[model samples]
Target: MFELNDLRQTRFYQDVFAEGKQKGRQEGKLETIPQLLALGLSIQQIAQALGLDEQLVKQAAQPKS
Candidate 1:
């Protein structure tokens, strides 16, 4: 029983860590949109290169408050 509980906890933490890593990668991609645009890439091109939606790329290109 103790071993099973430990294994569940470990799996839960591993899943959380994986999700965090994915989120970090997505944020990093969003951060790069401006630079890619500056380099003369269109919204569609940036989205294709980043494997993201064109709307997401356009949203990221918007100025922050």
Candidate 2:
């Protein structure tokens, strides 16, 4: 009695996926931030390590001051 029709929640799926992606991005930042800081990597190096754009890395690396 397993029917695929029971899984008709498109919005729910989207929300779940979005949340997962957001959490993953946060965790990745948490994991990479220290490496970047420890190595004293430039924005470009940090971006390369994370396979992200240098601008994105720079934005992420901005000090909290």
Candidate 3:
């Protein structure tokens, strides 16, 4: 039988895994921002099309250091 501490650790790991998946999905969407921009979509338009924040889209459009 699982102890309480074991159950808590399992839940913590599950939460972390779920968060990683979500971040990966967001990164994938961010990676698409430039392609959408190349297609002539404005930041606002891209955000609306992708259901992302306009600011986040703009940041993604910027060249990375």
Candidate 4:
């Protein structure tokens, strides 16, 4: 069972939630990588800047070309 508590009052919960949200946003960005690459972004460039795999970048570029 779970009860709704004021987790926000604790610094630990706040940090954890913030970190989780940041990670979620990062994952969302990764999901959109293909779309971003389709918009004429170079794979090497994307890979270098985003720290993503070049092969993944290439895959993303494929749908556009």
Candidate with the greatest lDDT versus the true structure = 1
TM-scores, each model vs. reference: 0.84, 0.54, 0.79, 0.55
- The total number of steric clashes, by the backbone 3 Å criterion, in model 1 comes to 0
Off by over 4 Å in 4: 1-5, 44-65
Using lDDT as the measure, name the better of candidate 2 and candidate 3.
3
Least accurate stretch of 10 residues (summed lDDT) in model 3? 4-13
Tens-place lDDT per residue, model 3, 1-65, is: 87877875797878987999999999999999989889998999999988899899988999999
Please, what is the whole-model Cα lDDT of each candidate in the order they appear?
0.93, 0.71, 0.90, 0.74
When sorted by lDDT, best at the front, the candidate numbers are 1, 3, 4, 2
lDDT (10s digit) by residue, model 4, range 1-65:
33347666678888999999988866775777776666877778788878878886666556553
Q: Give the clashing residue pairs of candidate 2, or none.
A: none
Task: Write the number of the candidate with greater TM-score, choosing between 2 and 3.
Answer: 3
Q: Tell me the tens digit of each residue's lDDT in model 1 across 1-65.
A: 56865865797878987999999999999999999999999999999999999999999999999
Model 3 pairs whose backbones collide: none
Off by over 4 Å in 3: 1-9
